[model samples]
Target: SGAVHFTRNNLSAYIRSNVRYLVALLVAGFDPSSGPELHYIDPFGSSVPIRYGGHGSGINFCTPIFEEFYKPTLDKRTAYNIIQKCVAEIQKRLVINLRNFDVFVIGREGITKLDPINQVSLRAQLMGNPPPRK
Candidate 1:
């Protein structure tokens, strides 16, 4: 689960096909100084905003949390923070709600597969142990 900001073109057939009724709730201000504008997409066809979005198996549970915690507008730094927190929350929910669920994050930079790390980290994070503190 993650959020993506489109640059210049908001062309993502994968997102459009999978996420029904995709809408651009907010758009970053045009900065001629900056290279490209930004847009948000929720891959599972949920909801959208300027700075936040997510998709995963526990999306129903995660969406509310994201909405509550997400800022209406966010700078690059804030966007990254929101993303990290969302990922952590999804990882948490997945561990408790299901035995196995893969998590993926995609953005302008690209997608990062979290299943392997999630499997190990979620167990420690949710299971209530510090996981060696290393």
Candidate 2:
């Protein structure tokens, strides 16, 4: 349903909270043989993949959906859609539970954020429609 934004310095804290507060899983895609690839790690001290990854509540429910939907290697378009869908699902859960939640996406290009102001616009784009029928 939405996305969260944070600076690199806060990444550790974010990972810690996600592990502590929710059932978290990391879905990553990477080529280890490549020189100097990136990796993601959580509070549990597990690290893997790089090109693409995510963690949060309902991850168990959503991951299989992603797996089936995701390609082994993704182009930018595929990666963007996958991430947008994942975040939208998280946002839906947060709204249904009346909980406030945030999501972060990290990559070699750095992080892209969808905070309060632009989330709606971004979501609209993700859904492949013009912004809501307002």
Predictions in order: lDDT: 0.47, 0.47
The CA lDDT at 98 in model 2 is 21
Best by TM-score: 2
Cα lDDT of model 1 by residue, 31-133, tens digit? 4454234454443333343444433466666677668766645554454444445557665665664434444444355555543334555457567653332
| Residue 20 Cα positional deviation in candidate 2, in Å, after optimal superposition | 15
Model 1 regions lying over 4 Å from their true place: 1-51, 95-134
Number of the top lDDT candidate: 2
Q: Lowest summed-lDDT stretch of 10 residues in model 2?
A: 1-10
lDDT of 2 by residue, 1-134 (tens): 00111222244465667543322334323233442244554444444544444454566556766777776566545555565566566666654442333343344545544332136656568567643221
Clashing pairs in 1: 6-39
